[model samples]
Target: MPRIVSAFLCAAFIALGVTACAEPAHQKHAPQDPPDYKGVPTDMTPPSMLTPSAKPQ
Candidate 1:
């Protein structure tokens, strides 16, 4: 009976050790979009057209 109990304990200890030493499962994360930023004007216009040209000196 003691031999059987010791053998069972040894087997349990080995199983627990193997599981504890194993690597954890990989976790995946969803890609996140950056914050919506409004910087430049939406309309594409040339600076020269927006402002009148200075008279040549």
Candidate 2:
């Protein structure tokens, strides 16, 4: 009876281990797009674009 019980417990542990190791492989993460700067320019033109003739003194 003891041997039967030990065998059952061992089988249960083995089944659990097998299931734990059978998880699906991790998926590759997709690269996220950079934030939009659609209406904005990167560089600022000197003397202001608003006042074209205002030269630096």
Candidate 2 — what's its lDDT?
0.81
- lDDT by residue (tens digit), candidate 2, 1-57: 999999999999999999899966775786665687456665687655666665799
Winner by lDDT = 1
What value does the lDDT take at residue 54 in candidate 1?
78
- Residue-level lDDT of model 1, residues 1-57, one tens digit each, is 999999999999999999999987875876665678547468788776797867998
All candidates' TM-scores? Answer: 0.45, 0.41
Ten-residue stretch with the least lDDT total in model 2 = 45-54
Which run of 10 residues does model 1 get worst, by summed lDDT? 31-40
